[model samples]
Target chain A: MTTLQAPDTPFLALDVDRVDANIARLRQHLDLLGTPLRLHVKTAKSVDVAARAFGGGTGPITVSTLAEAEYFADAGWTDILYAVGLDPHKLPRAQALVERGVDLTMLLDSITQADALVQHCRTHGVTIPALIEIDCDGHRGGIRPDSADLIPIGRRLADAGCLRGVLDHAGESYFATTADDQRAAAGVERVTVLDAADRLRQADFACPVVSVGSTPTAHATAELTGVTEVRAGNFVFFDLVMAGIGVCRVADLALSVVVTVIGHHGNEGIFTDGGWMATSRDRGTAQQAVDQGYGLVADIDGVLIPDLLMVGASQEHGVLSIRPGSSRRLPHLPIGTRLRILPNHACATAAQHSRYLVHHGGSTDVVSQWPRHNGW
Target chain B: MTTLQAPDTPFLALDVDRVDANIARLRQHLDLLGTPLRLHVKTAKSVDVAARAFGGGTGPITVSTLAEAEYFADAGWTDILYAVGLDPHKLPRAQALVERGVDLTMLLDSITQADALVQHCRTHGVTIPALIEIDCDGHRGGIRPDSADLIPIGRRLADAGCLRGVLDHAGESYFATTADDQRAAAGVERVTVLDAADRLRQADFACPVVSVGSTPTAHATAELTGVTEVRAGNFVFFDLVMAGIGVCRVADLALSVVVTVIGHHGNEGIFTDGGWMATSRDRGTAQQAVDQGYGLVADIDGVLIPDLLMVGASQEHGVLSIRPGSSRRLPHLPIGTRLRILPNHACATAAQHSRYLVHHGGSTDVVSQWPRHNGW
Candidate 1:
């Protein structure tokens, strides 16, 4: 096998076996729910890594940027949903994708965006599939299903022959403290999007697709009678945030930053070469009951160190400290000691590097290097 | 006059004229202090952007990673210092740069690291210059200036013929709220590094380089009689954090993420196509008296929107809300209206993109595309 070390002090490492298991676990749940998975490729922005999640097939995928839509198309994946609300200036790139025989779908929640897409289609003589974003839990962007503004925007898309359906993400599901809470959030997400889809159909807009998901909600969902497809990205490499929400356990984390001990402060903390630049500034856990400062420390073989957490960071330095009130002695990790750090949010931390050093679950041997489509 | 805009909604925009003015402002201050500037390239990471600071001549620079050290070397720059604490695994990359005739200097603070560098030099018959980091104000990494451990660490490098002098960064100065507080921090920075150099000299070591800096201290230093160089990177593209520290004004910020209005919630806030992905999760201003949530909102012409701040963000969504209790009616930014969003930390924000969209001051015109050295 291709096995070697990076020689650099900090790099991202991915456990392929763990990745496969996480994907299989989520797929089994969706299989029972009778909904196919439209894997969001935003978390792992690599073609090779996403291929592992598909298990040797080009599954339907969701994207956060046009760059991913074009990149996956070039890599021979056909179906894609550009999930972020559309900006008018990006219609050209969306046009190029549709013209190239790719099943490109755009998303929007405003009449202005719908009008822009209609105008672009008329200007270029093309058809770009689109979906209306429905806000289920008031997390961020999306139109309310019960609002009077829904049918007008749907009428614009339906008249332009571009309406796909309705989709809603239960963003609050990420903070659900129990499996029952996640399940309730998932059910609310389905009802909200299905309500919008039913309203669009009542107005004679053929709403064919109904989508619902978020990492926590995807796994917690037990039924999907009206949902056509579930979309999720972070489940393929579960992070501390997922674990905090009770969706997954700490052992299921598939991604980590490999760093080396460089120095130490007197009774303050141990310093590692990895910093916010290696790990990201995504302190997603800061809002949780117990904030894993930046991330939890693990050994090179992916074993968690007891009560030790990354408490502070600068640009290129991380301070590892024992949890407060714990009498556990600091481990004798001298200079040049290699360790793995599990991140709080996989998407944020994974974006810090351009490639991933892949290994199997039982071995630290390098198996491959997967490049990411990191920037727009 | 290359003036066509990026079809993408969110991209990094840099003001070249503002960059020149910021660089010149610091140079003028350092000129009175009799110290040359060793421009730290970690912020912009773009050769074109750094070229603006040098004014067409190649000046000495400091880097945070070996990839930067190698990249700047290939671009024909000579003197470079890798400013982070060194890990022994990176010795080969450093040796390769030294072999390629780049004046690369490394930093470290312990005996184990010194012995490793010595072993590598002895095994390969090559000399690698290095600096002993001194801890001033109980910061992250570095030995105490008066500690007896300093002479032993310095003696290792002096015996191996690779001793350069001492360096200390007044990292705590970033929190200073007054010019006097910043100046006092700068004064302490100087005394600490020079004190370490004096200790090395007493041990019969010829300490040649004496370095001290941080963005706030570099601007606050009024005298540098014994200091040879001041290293500061964020000064070239000041952010809200520096503004909060009283080091610069809000108008002095030169980098921003230009985004288009995508959607909006009823009374919560306005939504943009940019988010934590575009503006990074660097909430550096949270510790300040006035927490600029993620960043402050600005118009396309770099004018501030009154009392508007980015209060919340997701992967591809930013919510612009009015500061609480402000009666300023929310601006009527319809869909497709483009605006600039200033960042909380320039380095973290700049790392989100692969290239910069360069323009000049007082004119909204694209002049160039400068690529950045983003990943390790």
Candidate 2:
């Protein structure tokens, strides 16, 4: 068996057992609600992880980049929703995937994009499936469900025979400090997207799919009544941000950067080879009740070291120190001691790496090596 | 000629003219001091950029990862110094590079590492060149010049016939708020590394290379009398962080992310496909006097868009808005309008991409495609 110490430092390690548990929990929760889970592949970006996510079948998935759509399509997963607002220039690339028999879906909120996609489809003699995004909480891209342009945008795509549905992401749910806030956000997300879908239907536009999700909202939502599918990526590998928001426990975090101790400053902190480049600069937990500096520092066995946090990071070095006033002395770990750092955002941290060392059943032995795809 | 509109949105664009000028400025400065410039390839990681930095030769270079060492070595660049503290387990890989007629140098700052390297070389009967990292500004790694362990560590490597030099990076220089502060930090960095080198020589150890640099210090240092080489990386493509430190002007930054407008949120802001995934979560300019939100937004021609900043970002969307109280009206660019974002840190931002779309002489045309190597 390949041990944890086999690979070099500053590589990503996936706790396969934890990942399976997390996936099972989400699947069970959504399965009870009768909502299909369109797993966001943008987080793991690995065929191995996707295999586990979909139970070894070509399941519906959501992607942030067209590159991801191409990659997963090559891996035999055909149903894809490119979740990012569509760029007109990338229509050709998306159409190519559609021509290959993949049920590729594009997203957009503006009439400009609707018109452009319609033009591109007409010019290319191809009909592409698309989603009109709705702004649930004004977190990011999307037209408001009550906006006058919603029907027009939907009509444009419907006229082109390309309107597939309407989707919304409660991305602001990550900032929720209480469970009530998250649950409320999830409720609004569901109602907002459903309302947009209803408006499309009232306008003679068949809105078949009504999608809504964010990691926090996916778990916090009490009802998925009108939602056809939930698209949550970070839940596959819950991070510190998810834990901070009460969405998941720290123990549920499945991804971490395995690094090596390199040096220490007297009474200040210990340093590691894993910097922002490894752990990522996503300070998603900075505004939470308890700020996780860069990440929560864990021992080689994936156990959190009490009171320790990576407070600072450079390009290739991380400053691991005890939280101020917690202890007077720093951990006197000898150089070369390996540690794992739980990230603030799994998607951002996972994107920093090209592959993952998968550990099964909580063993130190790596059971598999999973390669991840990157770039747009 | 391939126009700027050819590539998909959210790809990095390198202004070759700006890159050449940035490199020339650093080269000219270092040339006057009669110190060789061992360019740090950790920033660009592209052979094309390295070629420009080395003036089309296999010149001495420094890398932050062994993977970079291997990639550049395969490209015919023999001299390399892996700048990060060495991991004992990676000795075999370093030795393999050494065996391949590549003068690959490793770095270490502790006695534990010194002993490990000596043991590894003794066991394999292969000599590996190494540098003793000195703590110049208490920013990151290295032992103090006057520390008792300094000479002992040098003697340990010297006894093994693997000691090559002493090096230090004044990373704290980045925190300097004024020109005088930066100059003073650079002065201290030079003296600290030189003192360690002198001490090693006094102990009968021939410390040949005394390398010192950080982009800020490299530009601010008024003298390099005893320094053998200046190792500066980000100077090849100055970033917002460097500009905030007064090392370079905004116009000198060569790298940018070309994105397309995807949506607008009333008068609050506009959104683009570029986000933390494209610009990187390097909030480097946040601490500066003028906080550049996520990054400074620019027009298609690379000219700074007045009063605008990428105020926020999600995974796949950047919220571009006019800074608060500035005109109160965001630019009315329709969806699909292309824009460029200047990153805060070149090293962190460039690491997000696999290739660069090179625009020579300020032309909108993409003249070349430069591939970059990532992952350790």
Predicted model with the maximum DockQ: 1
lDDT per residue for candidate 2 within B75-170, as digits (tens), equals 988999999998898999999999999998999998989999999999999999899999987889899999889988998899999899999998
Clashing residue pairs for model 2? none
**What are the per-model numbers of colliding residue pairs?**
0, 0
TM values, all candidates:
0.99, 0.98
* Whole-model Cα lDDT of every candidate shown, in order: 0.90, 0.90
What is candidate 1's CA lDDT for residue B166? 90
**CAPRI docking class of candidate 2:** medium
For every model in order, the fraction of real contacts preserved is 0.83, 0.74
Cα error of candidate 1 at position B166, Å: 0.2
The runs of at least 3 residues in candidate 1 whose Cα sits more than 4 Å from the true structure, single-residue gaps closed, are A1-6, B1-5
Q: Tens digit of lDDT per residue, candidate 1, span B250-314?
A: 88999999988899898668999898999999999999988999999988888889988898999
Residue-level lDDT tens digits of model 2 in A53-129: 77777699999999999999898889999999888888889989999999999998888889999999999999997
lDDT of 1 at B306: 95
- Per-residue lDDT value at A195 in model 1: 93
